[model samples]
Target: MSAEPTAETLSRPPTTSGEAVAVHGVTRRFGDVVALDDVSLDVGPGEIVGLLGPNGAGKSTLLSLVSGQRRPDTGTVRLFGGDPRDARSRTRLGVTPQETGLPPTLRVGEVADFVGGHFPDPVPTPELLEQFGLTDLARKQTGALSGGQKRRLAIALSLVGRPRVVLLDEPTTGLDVSARQALWDAIRQYHAGGGTVLLTSHYLEEVQALARRVVVIDRGAVRADDSLDAVLRRVALRRVVLTAPADLSTWAGVVRSRPVDGAPPERQELFTPDADVLVRDLVVSDVEFRDLEIRGASLEEAFAEMVAPESTPESTPESSPSIEGAVR
Candidate 1:
């Protein structure tokens, strides 16, 4: 294939009309395992959507179908206005999987230029490097780069082609706090430029950081899809901490409760939908309660409740052996 884009490619515009990603009643199965079951979602232009799900919940499978890495067993997958399997459609799409390989001998700048060369209007190598904070390491070979640097470069490559839509699967799996923040900034810049993003994250904080809209998937099914606050509201349970006279687990609003072990006497925690009513009852009944505290649940707490009673597999930074090769 030619490194440079042809006129036909240049003439084709970004995904400016209709949904950037559309999946309707899609079912994808691997042998006996159903990866996706009747999944339907529409992501409009310039939207940042977060796909949150536990491991084995089909997050990766859904991304694979959308990115054309795998064909769905049933239903349709569309990218831009065309089929995802078509190169013509993929021209407007960019992707970074959970894991990526870098050429060991290629310098950072060289790799960027080589990838950028494939697009009709690629970001300039210098400008891209500077934007991603890879300018200082421009001359450094990939083999010598640190884990965080490789991750930053991997994401930077996704935008090299100025794609209108990008699919990221667990984008920030492993990185220091500062490096993760830098990547988040880059993502924000791209979205602010009207680029649409659909990303899956194991970290609730990551989804909270980048997604205005959140979609929770479980057992190959969509549990919730709405604005961040709206989805969080799904977890109506509240936490009440206090020093009570006796067990509060049997209280009217309490869904679950436990004693703060190894602490002061009668110290307990109560979870309920209405914290105010729960506390009001305590005061009305004149329960010998002291140090009462009530607060709304955080995003993390909500996530835990949403996918309760299941073990969530975390996607930590991959610890892989060094890859030795040279390619753009």
Candidate 2:
């Protein structure tokens, strides 16, 4: 960094500010379309939360409200016990949007140090660069970096201020496997240092690896909010892949079954509530099977079940609390 890091620039935000985030009955709309419907969530101080959802599931909209980029049509959003819209509240906040516009001409180190200058106390540019695995690219211009490097720098920029609460929107979107893991490690270190984080992602592995507390959202509403294990248990569907000669669609506990397209028509997939029960049924019926494999359903399947229109008869904002209450 061209700017020298001084003692005055190494300060940190107060860490005991109770709840770092509080959203109550937030509603936002664009024209006639409701982007968010009376959604409310809380993230305590020093907690890491991942808002998991598919594209356009209101994940970005909710993060926008929390970061004060946009206001909710109705309801409130608080950060560190103050209105997020207020400058004072935002001073303690650091945010990375779904996409960031970096000055192409500026070097990576220069951009970081410049942003750090805006805060009362900021992390040292070199230290921040080391944390995000960007130290090697410090002299490189922002526009010359690869997509993954740019993403890593975007997230690193959010932490330059050493803010108490950090909000990240789709932090690893479009990143490669290695770059994503490197960014995840940086985020983990930030959380390890007691920095409260609220991030949104459509990647299941991203949420699964980073967040202990997850809030699943779909179609502009909260579907499930709980521990990762509890969320997985709630959608406990097993996927059984095998080569079965007899039809498995009629098996007990089978949610859905379909034949996989391949040579000899032997491959098939059986989605069931209990793979053991289905296997027992198969054994009792003398059905021939081969290459059998039983595994837990993917997050995509769980998300599908959560958002499936036929699964829930009630899809109104008024019923949200009751459903959430039931989950708790």
Candidate 3:
């Protein structure tokens, strides 16, 4: 029951400067605490950008500003080059916040229709429900759906208006693997039809799968914003796993080493900047090792390094000049 792109999907408004979303030097505070500090970001039309950060790192607050739920204290947020706070500007924008309050007594289909009725042009309720895998729950009351179903319906409603840009805050927080993949497909379909998306997720793999560009925020500041490959490459660490007779934790070229849990005592995993150099050292030293394996760092490893307490701004790769000072 997948829905094909409608005429409205192909007729998005031309963006100013080719930017779907623009946030410049935005700052927001909550009494004594600064939620966002001089953050600036831009999402081009038709791009899927991932916003990543720890809890209370201002990720939600930033989305609130972009979605016009909250105003910035000292900067500007624009949707298609217009003030986001303006209703006319928001007509083309869609948002799924971390929490949504659906009508308890309304059926799923009824809620979809109610939301779609607000826009001049909207995706048909049936098609939208099918695309999100909610057709079976169409007749069920909103409060009766499971947590994951509610999340899917919330995301589907965001697209009822066929918006040019959508902001998703933890869209797959409660979804299972299958449900998450289904939602990913729906997002891809929307993007293929020239829609722009900005999403935040704790799942690193979600960002790795959907976004070409990644923006990492921590401590109320932009830590790094660059292509996913560039961000991963910035962390030069590689993981090497092998079974060795002798302890390799103190070996030269090994940045960190630990025993592989549930494995034999000889099985060790090592982190090193250069796997080749470490292997060379192992061979030269006549180390007795077997089952050797070497692989590049994962997004999780890269993220850990990026937000590590010891990481300083000066240590950041020159390619990611957008990174602000170290997380304090």
Candidate 4:
């Protein structure tokens, strides 16, 4: 590839007409054990999709298939309407793995420049370093950076090619609150610039905040794929906390409320999806309480219920090891 392609040769014009990614009846297995089972989904341009599941729930496998690192045994995966494994097709995608795989001795700027050399039109090394908060450490060796700095550098490296679709697997793994926030802002900017993002994260708050849609997979299959609002409504289990003025038995419509062990009996509440009607009737009937709180079910809670071990195999690999190699 040329060191740099001009605006006309390098930039892939924004397309309002492509399925950024598409997987149909995808399945993969290891001998007798299935890793992914007939999973199918579509990601459109400029959309951020969250993939949520428990350990060994095929989250990483699915991402690998989409990124062309692994092929599905039973189905087809298309990136920009071409085979995922094709080199030309892959240039359109960027990836950030959970662990940093950067060379320890390379300076931050040098590392970015080295990776950028692979692209026809790389984002300027200095701009990317600054964009990811690594400007101050531009000449610092990767080995000398802190955990969060290393992570930020890894993220900057992933974007060197200015890819159209970005796959982020636990993109904010080791960053502190401020650093994590910075990454989130960068991601928002990426999406705003018309790039597609597919994120696999165990952090429910991360998914809820960043993803416009979510695809929940369990037992190697897609259990649910829908918008955040729709998914939350379907995964209807709310957390209810309240203070009781009298005995639990006296409270009407109280599904269940027992004092926590070693806790005051007067302070009791329970979790239920029907919080609106349930609490409304109680208050109307003169139920007295010092405090009350009703919170919606989070993606974590929904994920726990969806991918509970009962539906998966007894033993399986917990996590995929991060791929490591020099960026050639």
Most TM-score-accurate candidate? 2
Better of 1 and 2 by lDDT: 2
Native-vs-model 3 lDDT?
A: 0.80
Per-residue lDDT, model 3, residue 206, is 81
Best by lDDT, which number? 3
Candidate 4 local lDDT, 19-45, one digit each (tens) = 889899999997897999999999876
The runs of at least 3 residues in candidate 1 whose Cα sits more than 4 Å from the true structure, single-residue gaps closed, are: 1-17, 97-100, 235-304, 307-328
Worst 10 residues of 2 by lDDT: 1-10
Of candidates 3 and 2, the better by lDDT: 3
Off by over 4 Å in 3: 1-14, 97-100, 235-304, 308-328
Task: Put the candidates in lDDT order, highest first.
Answer: 3, 2, 1, 4
Give the TM-score comparing model 4 with the true structure, all chains together.
Answer: 0.75
Residue pairs clashing in model 3 are none
Measure candidate 3: CA RMSD: 6.8
lDDT for position 186 in model 1: 86
Candidate 3 to truth, TM: 0.76
Tens-place lDDT digits, model 1, residues 1-328: 1112233234433455478899989998888877888999998777789998766779889988888888888888988767888777787788873335888899999989988887889999999999898999999998798888888888998899999889888888878899898898888878776778899986777888898899998768888999977865675568788997787778887765555546675888676778988889988998888998888755434444465444334221221112100100
Candidate 1 deviates by what RMSD? 10.5
How does each model score on TM-score? 0.75, 0.79, 0.76, 0.75
Error at 178, model 1, angstroms: 2.6
Tens-digit lDDT string for candidate 3 (184-206): 88887788788888999756778
